[model samples]
Target: MEVRELLAQTHKLPNVPDIVRELIQQLNNPNADYGDIADKVIKDQTLSLKILRLVNSAHFGLSRKVSSINEAVVMLGMTQLKTMVIASGIAGSVKEVDGLDLKKFWSDSFRVAALAKWYAEKSTGVDPDTAFTVGLIHNIGRLLLHITKPKLAEAIQTLVDQSDCSRSDAEMERLNFTTPEAGQALLALWQFPENLGDTVRYHRQPLSAEAPSPLCATLHIACYINAAIGKQQPLEEVIAMFPSAEAELAGLPANIAAVSEEAMQIESGLDGLI
Candidate 1:
């Protein structure tokens, strides 16, 4: 199927939680208040509960258990709350996709988010929460494909396994576009931030982005670090493979080993949410 048709099918799948849309509006409004945002979140009981659970999870390492959305807002701040809402919203919509293990997919996504946020915090010119959200949602196109066109997704996977090529290469060969392209289209449909759309679109090749985006570069290196960890590559080799130029653009350290360790730690703490 054409990428356009695939994206149209994705739009027909299901709408994200209403609260997510509302929260996005709040994020865009400079006059929005923290209490107002928290109120919007609590209106969706399921999403609010999920957010509260994750906020109180060991992943956050909060000093006290968050007992309410208001408390969560106070503790996590609006930026982190927005990230949780987006994650919960996406999770609510796409629980399972054919031919994909949601568990492993989300696990990998969480690792990338952790690594990206870690790198973003150490860098300048990018918000860590935005980087985290971009990392978490980057591969949504793969899930979209599995749900809307499982045969195509399966074919891409087979080629990936047979040729031992990267997923981006397999996707480009089979579908005429990579997962990041599809992800960008989907994000645009969802009314997410343009910066986020660009981050997902160019994560595989950050320097190829039309404009310099520090978050995109951060995700690029974070993905590399995730791949290294998956292969159990030696730390020295992982460091050697670090995209130094991209890291420089993102203003992030190329310390692959340190970022890998942090990603593992964060991934472990986020077990229940995924």
Candidate 2:
């Protein structure tokens, strides 16, 4: 399929659920009231309940702990709220891609989000919470793409593993659409901030000079390292992806991305706690 055909076809894609739309809009607005946001969250029985559970979960560092939606909002702040919103939407939103492995995907996404958050804390341009969420959702387009075009998804996977090709480029060659492109489209329809959608669309192509979101560039590097560490992509391919990202992240700290075996063990312990 030509890239133009894929773009034209995806126009008919479905929008995210109403709850995500509302959540994204609220989060994008810096002036949105927390009380009002809390009210909207509480109205959704499932979301409200999940927020409460997540607050009490070991993953969160609550000063005094929480047992209700209101408490979660006050304790976690907007970024955490946004994370839960994405998580809630994620739980029920996606359909499985027959050839894909959900467990691996979640593991990689979670680890990447964590790693991204750690990196964000050391950086100046990005927000820790937002970076974490970005890492988690960076490849979200791949999920929808997998469902919409499983054969192509499978072929992309095979090419990624067998050949020394970057996942996005291989996908583009096969499906005529990168995961970022699909993700950007989906996020826009869901009413997410255009910056987030744009980041998702261009993370792999950060050198496009036309790229505007520094946050997206941050996310792209985090994901590049994330996939490399988890044995999800070839190291050589990861090296190939880093030059533009290196340029994007000039100055600041020179942090090496590859996590050690001990790091994996640390992540495993943390995962059990989360």
Which candidate tops lDDT? 1
lDDT agreement of model 2 with the native: 0.64
lDDT of each model, Cα atoms only? 0.77, 0.64
Question: What's the TM for model 1?
Answer: 0.87
How does residue 152 of candidate 1 score in lDDT? 92
Residue 196 of model 2 has an lDDT of 75
What is the C-alpha lDDT profile of model 1 across 119-186, one tens digit per residue? Answer: 88889777776777788888888888888889999999999888879999998888888878888888
Q: Give lDDT tens digits, candidate 2, residues 187-208.
A: 7655677777877787776657
Candidate 2, which segments miss by more than 4 Å at Cα? 2-15, 61-66, 74-79, 232-251, 254-274
Q: How much does candidate 2 score in TM-score? A: 0.75
